[model samples]
Target: MTTSAMETAVEVEQRYGFDLIDLETVRYGLIEIAREMNDTLTRGSFSPLARDIRDCTSAVHMRTENGWEMLASHEGCVQHAFTSPHIVNFTMSEWDESTLREGDVILVNDPWRGAIHFSDLNVLQPIFVDGRLEFVLHSTSHVADLGGPIPGGFANGAQTTFEEQLKIPPTLLYAGGVAVRPVFNHLLENNRTPNLLLGDVRALAGSLSVGASRLNSLFERYGLGHVRASGEYAMDLAEAAMRRGIATVPDGDYVITDSLDEDAIVAEEITLQMTLKVRGDSMEIDYSGSSRQPAGNVGTAWIESTRAIIGTKFILDPASPVNSGTLRPIEALLPPGSIVCVLPPSSCSSHTETGSRVVNMMTQALSEAMGARGIACDTGTSGVAVIGGVDERPGHEGSPWGSFAVPGGGWGGTWTSDGVSACIVSIAANCRSAVNEHVERESPLVIWEHELMPDSAGAGMHRGGAGAIFTIGAVSTTVITITGDRSRSGAPGSSGGGRGMPFYGWLLRGDGSGSTLDPRRAIGAEPLFGVFDENGEPDPDKGTFGLGTTYMGGKVSQLVLQPGDGIRLIVGGGGGWGDPLERDTERVLTDIDDGLVSESFAHAAYGVVLDASGAVDEDATAMRRRDLARLRDQNKWSVPTACPPAWNTATIMEVAS
Candidate 1:
């Protein structure tokens, strides 16, 4: 802060009879408190999305005159940073500070009311001092299952929200310092995996208690008023810092348009457009021209996911603390009834499929504005694959088990380094992939292989990251759902670069011979209701007769398999950054030796040929590079008709139960 601004802040502190220096220390203390809550939740949760995917967030907030303002948050997911405060805003009218009790906790998961989706439930506690409310602690986590036909909450195809699952408003899960038994029991009775999810709820409540305890200690030591003001000061600093960053960028209206691979509900494409207006020290993202509510579970009514996408654009660092100030300057024009902001009663269970695509689309646009600071497109699919069956994995004879896996693809290249391989996309901040050993132990399946694909990364001066291929076999009858895209088109590159290879996979027979089954007849794990005629139903007569076989890409419904049937999943690579022929010949040879790129592909894509001994043939390489450049100019190497990297993402999903 400037000297004059500091004096003004001091004057405000004096007026309130609080010490500014004390408030500063209290700021750091609040941050530690949030961290404690995050650790508690991570260690205490049971579901893979929570423990493995890290699909959760924690924050402490102070309500201001305008609305709830974020004070400190867990330094984790970018999508969670600026969106937590908005969650409080969504429930403000329903319940205010005066209405909350000292020990009462409220729960909400309705997507229209500040949640990412129906699967993610949030637990909130109002912090009080001397019988007066001062701060509120909020925690959110993605649970594996809710009461429904599907194992997880992602019902890929359903006409209305009623079919999605249970929809709880901002109601008190706890009343007057006691756990509400009726609410708890109701949830348990509704879900298939009650034992696993109950533990998740308890963990969320535990995190709230932990955060409250640590925050109370800070208030007891520094006085609640001073601590609150310190939070205010911290937000002020964050807003100022963000303004400075905005001022550094050139002011202009930067617009970019893109689309998803296909709507899993039907054979249609979905579009997402972003027009960023950078003013003196502010930004406005206008999604005015995007596609409206199409028929499917592809889009959602949740704005939290949109805000998270905007938040990721502002702060690239994964560990930065995101308060309300980080999003204070951006004005969004998300037209109601649009894909991201769908109307209520539309199934948004798997909204992340399309929401993640928005994150990639915006990132591509930002990279054009600021080359050094921006990143390229991502393997935009959530890569959702659901496998479920009776537990035959030893010791458990007939218990049913279901597993959800989002096999991550390669990341797009950036100015600083090559895109990362087999990592979660930008929106899934700090999420961990499921381990092969764990998958084997939990379900009746064996993870055969998990290795990076060769010649997968987009060829460039600095290549994009390589994706991976995984194969799994069922020990018994298993059902599979494939919600994927990019089978035909791959992650597109930029700056005269080329796209990476698209996804490819198949279902193989048990005998280890040539494949014997074809999944072409499958309606997908989660097929849009055969109700195109308003029948709203699945027709077994037309559905797959249990042929769980190979699928190149696109959505497929419940593909069934006999014992020994297995799947081979290949994830796509990230988009390249620059011209492939411009890449260094030595790097190309080194990539070959490391098994990242094939020698044939290296020579074909990068004009870098090797001699008989496998070293770079400089003279021949120079000639080849010139010839490649000439061909590129002639549109021979250009993807004149190829989809843009941000376009045609496999944002589609199919639910298999």
Candidate 2:
């Protein structure tokens, strides 16, 4: 209360407020750069995945307590600076330069050397303001073809890391503000889509240049000291925000376990377990008892996996800043060589699978601790990319092209709402499936159907989102490969919600006959392959097959559709929230009208008894629910299974048996 104390307090508030504003402004500048980078890639990239599928990420970095701090507004990719800060630091250290030249750019894609994989190309450029390293701009993208054993670089059976794709370390991609033509040429020559790669790389460079220019402008407007101080302020603000969010949840220890359908490379299922111990305003997640790494280097490390889970939580709650400071409250322990913490020489091309499971497990655990405050589980996995060879057209030069198609699946229903249908889940949030029209025109394939699979979502008070079904067929002789999860088991639901549908793949023959395909299998010269419906139905057939899998050969109809063969893709639905009977009548009616929920579902699940006129009989519904409640109480209702099975369990059991 003294004058001196009051004066000190006023000065602190004023300084902090000023720094906070400056920090936000700088963060926006960085975001602008990231957006530009994304746009540049979308516009310039020649590959279907980059231009159409949009599988890429961009970020800006400044020095911080954790080595390099990721600026707000950047989409964090699996192995980029956002998820792997240590990798960025390692790259920067290897460069060993305090001051960076104006035109300097570095490219790296070595998973063993701070990069995610050879499929993902990373380009980093340091922004120097007045001859000092001020900021780092980086971008990452999933190139359609990277000259790997497989067309899409997702070699599920890849025995060695070298077979995955071209590996690059901390190589100088650009020096003195000029493109390294030799290096660029080397990369282009090794890939199937040279024109696309070259264009996308330039786009990345352009994005970095824009970010550097922005940083310089900010420095010119505000002193360098202020800019640097602002970066620190951003971290401080994020730390404070995260602490506040954590403090809201009651402190306690909670644990949950989940598993991968199976390791794609090795045909064994693996579990990911976590015990979250939350103290006053901090928490730690331990994966000590989780499954160890696969026999080979085929998974991700525990620390990185844990970081990814934490990253998902942070992203969902943006109020909590995403940085090392926010992660201070979280700790993870995984035995070395465990699936969660694989050591070197391990093939980690599929590390994202473990990371996704970790996210699901962590979220499930936190939901148990905090009840309804947690979001529902997403559709368990992002179905893998099915890349194959391009069929040749007579007049058009034959070249290889592929589709990075994503199957849709169920999302976990939340406390207040149903899950989003037909969407990719957490790990690849920014990537999307290519449109059929564009895909077929560019590649030698025919897309059959892209429709929603009804009743595939788990039922509850609020039903989960619906899954999707898509089909495609080879127009010529081509090779195909698939890499993803959720074929063995479906995504689990929460509370009283029903489990979502599982994913499946198959190959269809010319005579309406079909054979099941393993989710991880790579095939050559297949006529037709696609996702199946919940009832195991294939998309309407289209086109005809030719010899040798090439659409161009005789009796092949040039591999172009004579109109009856195709590939199909099906996405899963999200889970529902709460008990169906507990859902409000109005909400149930709304869902019925929206075509998301069926009339039978409304009555069976929500207990909303309806008359012949499709009108809800309030009194009848109330009476039905009362009886259901009595039955539930008699059975000691508590777990999600307290209610009747959501799907036709009898039929499913009979089929399986």
Top candidate when judged by lDDT against the true structure: 1
| Candidate number with greatest TM-score | 1
Clashes of each: 16, 52
RMSD after Cα superposition, model 2? 7.4
Candidate lDDT scores, in order, read 0.69, 0.60
lDDT (0-100) at residue 398 of candidate 1?
77
Summarize candidate 2's per-residue lDDT along 1-657 as a digit string, tens digits.
Answer: 101212343453466545444556765665566677667666767777667767776776787656776664355343343454545666787887754587899988776555665778888888776676757777778777678666656566554566567778888899878988889988989887776678778877776777677667777887777766666655555556666667777788887877765554454567777887878766777777778777533466433533445533542355544544445555666677777766666666655556656766766776677776555566666666555664466655467666667665656777767777777666666556687788777777766566666555766776777776556666666565544455444566667665565554434444433222221121211422222223323211121111122121100101223223444444456656667778788877877777656676566556788788877889999998888777778994422311112322122212222
lDDT of 1 by residue, 1-657 (tens): 311234665685765456666666787888888989988998898877676677788999887876788888884454665567767778765785566788899999888887877788889898888987777899998887775546676665665788777889998888877999999998998876677789999999999999999998887787876887787777766666666666766778888887765565655667888887888877887888889886777776756335534534444433335677666766777688888788887877766667667776676766777765666567766666777766654578777776777677888877666788887666775676676677777778877667776766777767788877666778878877766665546677766556765655555656554232221222222222111111212112222311232332356556776777777666667887777777878888888899787666777778888899989999999998899788878987652211111211111122222
Q: Give all candidate RMSDs, comma-separated.
A: 7.1, 7.4
Superposed model 2: Cα runs more than 4 Å off: 1-23, 76-81, 98-100, 295-298, 302-307, 310-316, 319-328, 512-564, 599-604, 607-609, 617-657
Cα deviation of 35, candidate 1, in Å:
1.3
TM value for model 1:
0.87
